[model samples]
Target: MPITEKEVRKIAQLARISIDDKDICSYEDQLNKILAFVDEMKAVETEGIIPLAHPSEETQKLRSDKVSEKNQRESYQSVAPTTENGLYLVPQVIE
Candidate 1:
């Protein structure tokens, strides 16, 4: 389907774009080429190829689930400028 100026205008309006007369011609050619590419792609035959997330044939490494030592919060909070009841104090930024 060839992209029309009217269709471009309608799409631009929907997208809140401000395309002028000079840019419309350039955009029209671009859109027509993209539509032509899609038209060509529709002719290809794909019978058995499966669509996949990753193109490579490799499995991800698995890790064994085990309980680990938790991080020491008291040690980490020592770096903060101010702390009260295990909470970091921050300056008020909002009204």
Candidate 2:
């Protein structure tokens, strides 16, 4: 369907985009072309085709779920300026 100038203005308003008076016709033409392409795509036959998330049939590979690092809280706290009972100390800013 060919888009009208009024419809294009409404679209620009809804999308919060600025459109010049000279560019309105250009935008309307582009939008009409896109609508025509969508209309053409709707006419294509897909009666038995199953919908899929991916284009390829192969599944993605994943690594094994396991813990690779040990907890070193004491070691990390040793490098801090002030630490007590495995916790870092910071100055109070708010009353």
Candidate 3:
């Protein structure tokens, strides 16, 4: 069903949008066209069509998972104010 001008005005009011009086007819026409297009799309036949994640049939290129950096945890944590069992200690903020 096509959207009426009164519905368009109500929608603008509900959304708290301030539309010009001349623009209300334009919005009503645009919304009606969109609804008509949706109705047209609903009539298409798709009995056995499969949904697709992507339009193209290409696989992603992945690199091998490997460690590329040396461990620097102890070197970095050495400057912290407090640490116990390799964990930095922070003052409790909540009870």
Candidate 4:
């Protein structure tokens, strides 16, 4: 069904938009055209069409998961002000 000007105004009001009087007709026309296009699309036939995640059939190149850096925990903790059981101590700010 085609959208009416009154319905367009109501939609604008509900969406908290301030549309001009002349623009209501334009909005109504655009909305009606969209609905007509949707009606046309509904008539298309699609019996066994499968949906796809991507349009192209290319595979993504991936790298192997491996450790590339050496451990520096001891070197970092040596410079800390307070560390107990390999954990840094901080002043409590909340009660």
| Best-to-worst TM-score order | 2, 1, 4, 3
Per-residue lDDT tens digits for candidate 3, residues 2-63, read 78989998989999998899998899899898888888877889789987768888788887
10 residues in a row with least lDDT, candidate 1 = 60-69
As a whole number from 0 to 100, the lDDT of residue 22 in candidate 4 is: 81
TM-score of each predicted structure versus truth: 0.44, 0.45, 0.42, 0.43
Q: What lDDT tens digits, residue by residue, belong to model 4 across residues 1-95?
A: 78888899888989999899988888888899888888886687877888676888888888789887799988999999999888898988688
Worst 10-residue lDDT window, candidate 2: 51-60
Compared to the true structure, candidate 2 yields what TM-score? 0.45
For residue 82, give model 4's deviation from the true position in Å.
44
Question: Candidate 3 — which residues are off by over 4 angstroms?
Answer: 44-95
**Model 4: per-residue Cα lDDT at residue 48:** 89
Question: Higher-TM-score candidate among 1 and 4?
Answer: 1
The superposed Cα distance between candidate 2 and the true structure at residue 91, in angstroms, equals 38
**Candidate 1: residue pairs that collide:** none
